[model samples]
Target: MKYLAVLILLVTACKSPTNKKMEPKTYLDIHNEAIVIDTHNDILMKTEDQGVIFDQDLTGQTHSDLERWKTGGLDVQIFSVYCDGNTKNSYAIANRQMDSLDAVVARNPDKIVKVANSKALLKAVEAHKIAAMFGVEGGHMIEGDLNKLEALYNRGARYLSLTHNAAPDWATSAADETTNPDLEEKGLTDFGIQVIKKMNALGMMIDVSHSGEQTFWDVIKLTNKPIIASHSSVYNLASSQRNLKDDQIKAIAKNGGVIMVNFHPNFIDNSFKAKAQAFFERHATEGDSLVKSGMDTWYMQDYLYKKYADEANQIRPPLATLINHIDYIVKLVGIDYVGLGSDFDGINITPQQLDDVTDYPLITKALVERGYSEADIIKILGTNFLRVLDANEIK
Candidate 1:
């Protein structure tokens, strides 16, 4: 009996814990070891406008700084130079934002390197430096001039997302399709197609994140290289116009492109739209007043957002929902064509539990828990994006 009791104790000791085996290293350890890349981040604007310093540690916000990104194990980050479409001086705004990013890289030469190609990205990683890349967030920033596109590209812009809320006359936004019948036939104008081809020739990535469905299809038909939806989620999950529909997801994969999931609350939760609508309604009159006063919608949005942030949290979706979108895209497109484009600093509210760039490891941990093989997870984290970058690099 004594020997049997001793044997039972030994068996119990040998049994694994109830939880699956996970290393004691914090999520950062896992995240750092991987070549983690976030395809979209709006921290450049935050750093420039809000005086946030990328080289310093961030205390309150979820957006990234160089130190935080390094701590989170982020190897590459494409800083989005986002200017609201309403700005008359969109090109100037874009330039200023780019300059801001340049300044950050200059200040932190030891920590970050501005990279334009796969070789630079790889070199930066080998040197343990953060690869800093640029992406223009809206096509409108080019102000209808293809020359401006070349100039932006020359100035280190690596990708251009085709349009924001206001679609060009030849394209219908997903938001306006329900009310605008004229947009039905308008996908890409001859000029738009020319612009896409120009991008292909220049080796600048064509980002279809905020484009109308017709525009998306048109670009797919025109571009010879892989494209990306820099910061979008699955429409089936959130029912947002900003999210990709099932057909769009499949099409992106078929084109040898990638879809980087967005972490905005409205993009992750279907039910949050009503709350957003109500929030906008309550501030509608004030918003119009601010617009009349010559304040851009982005400024007015920040103002009104502060008033509603607390209430907004009550309806914010869980971070798990963002993962669900990632999972959906992976299942539909396979693991090789998905990545993350967390719209940090650009978004007013994020999903719960994802407060900022520092929270990236949570995703790595979650992906592991979801039965993703480490190899597959690494691809989703950044390799897929690097592959597209390599394929699209201009000679």
Candidate 2:
């Protein structure tokens, strides 16, 4: 009888806290265990702007800092090497961007390390260093030189976004397509085909983020290895020219590529773009004065937006809106084809909750709430990108 009673007690004690709900996995636990990779971040450009080094704390002023990246559990970050089309010396500017990143890695060897390939990337992550890499934001930076492309790859530029908002002589941009619909070449030029082959041969990932639809398809048809939309969102959700259409998203998946959703509220919500447009019209005179004053139009507008932070916040979508883009890509293609490319520092108005680089854990928590398994979240967080990276690595 005593044995029976003890057995009953043991069974009851071990009876699986079924009545008590299993506590959800802490976000920190998930974020810490996962190898988090942000494919696109533009804080490097900000460093160049203010002559401020990333090794120091750049809180409030920028979305990312060295310590903040570490605190955010950023295993790998591909710093964007970008200069708009106006710079006469585009190639020189690109080299200078690379130089800045080199200097940062030189200064903080323990905190971050520049990675040239998947092998080195994994090694840096294993050693608890943020694996730093370069992603040239515009093909114009190469100045139509295959040699320049080769040089960039050698310089640890793992990806080359075919275009920024402005298409070069060799490619067309989404912005150009939308604003002026009568361009001669909507995609890559013949020489541009040569560039694609060169990138493929060098094993550099091709980014179709800011490319026109024709440009996207042309590259999609040519690239041998898997490609990526490094920092684009879904057009269906936001109705922005910058975001990909359903067919494009499927094409990326069919080509074994991944789409790292951008966090721009304008790209995530159409209503936000409308609100932004209205705000811009309201401040048109101030914007022109700021431009005339040699203040960067972006900074002036940012200042105005912050001055109206409450109104701006009202228009800004919630964190769930950003996740919805992720969900759209995951649902349309598959979990293997979607990831996060926050476009932090590059964007002015971020989703409400994602204030800075430190807010990445919220994404994991949101995913858990959305019923994604840990494995699925891992794939979305970084593994999918790593797979694409490994595939594109030079043998």
Candidate 3:
């Protein structure tokens, strides 16, 4: 009887809750342990416009900072090298944006490193440093010169978005495709074909985020390597021209590329547009005053949006809506071709519960709740982008 009691006590102690050594990892653990990457962020453009330092504490004024990026568990980031078409020296201004990022890397050498290839990217991730690279958001910054494109690539730009809101001489943009009536052409020009070939030769991933439908098809017909729609969502879900149609999504998968979905509310939720439009109309006088005071247009909008965040929050889509975009792509193609490209600091608004860089874990948690397997969650988080990056590498 005494030996039986001793054996029972030992068994109970061994089965205690605190004694569980092989317990399953939670969503937070999975998120923190994965190699999370954000393929597009326009914080550099904001920093340049506002004359603010990226490594400094910019809690309220900006959506990203070095420390906040770390807190967000971002293993890699592709900073956007951007300028509007109005700039006379677009190439020089783009270089200045690259210089801004370079300065940030110099200031936070221990926290981040500028990586150009897959090996360096892996090394940065292994060392727990954010791997930084550039996705030149507008091809106009190349100023119709292949030499300038090569120079941007040499400066750590791994991808070149063929257009922004406006088309360059080489390619048409979504804005022109759906809105412009006087447009002479709607696809890539002869030089644009050359640009695609040059990017293929240089091993830079061709990004078609802001490209018009015709431009997208033109590149798809011409490119030798896989491409990336670096920051776009599904048009079926939200009717924005910036969003990809079902045919485009299918084609991207067929061409072996990934679509890193954007988190902007306007792109994720169709209804948010009318609500946002109303909000803008309600604050039109204040917006006019800010612009009249010589503030930048984007800055004035950002100011109004943040100042009236309560009104803004009422219209913001739930985080699940963004996930639904991911889910749609996953179901349309497969898990191998979808990932996150949260357009941080570039858009005026994000989905609810995703306020800034640190809110990334919420996405992981939501994925888990959505019944995605851990393997698929990891792929969606970063591995899919890595696969596309590797596929685009020069062999």
Please state the error at residue 268 of candidate 2 in Å: 0.5
RMSD of each candidate?
9.5, 8.5, 8.7
lDDT of 1 by residue, 17-37 (tens): 333565564434445556788
191-243: candidate 3 lDDT, tens digit per residue: 99999999999999999999999999999999988899999999999999989
Question: In angstroms, how far off is 315's CA in candidate 2?
Answer: 1.9
**How do the predictions measure up, each by TM-score?**
0.86, 0.92, 0.94
In candidate 3, position 167 carries an lDDT of 68
Q: How close is candidate 1 to the true structure, as a TM-score?
A: 0.86
Report lDDT per candidate.
0.80, 0.85, 0.89
Model 1 deviation from native, Cα RMSD in Å: 9.5
Put the candidates in lDDT order, highest first: 3, 2, 1
Itemize residue pairs with steric clashes in candidate 3: none
Q: Write the per-residue lDDT of candidate 2 for residues 1-395, one digit (tens) a residue.
A: 24323432343233123335556656666677677889999987776666777788888777888999987778889899998876678888888888988888999899899887766776676677889899999999998889999998999999999999976888889998888857766888899899899988988999999999999899988999999999999999999888999999999999888999999998898889778888888888888888899988777877777777787777778999999999998888899999889899888888988888999999998998999888788789887888888788777
Write down the lDDT that model 1 would get.
0.80
In candidate 1, the residue pairs with backbone N, CA or C atoms under 3 Å apart (3 or more residues apart, or in different chains) clash, namely 62-356
Give per-residue lDDT, candidate 1, residue 59: 53
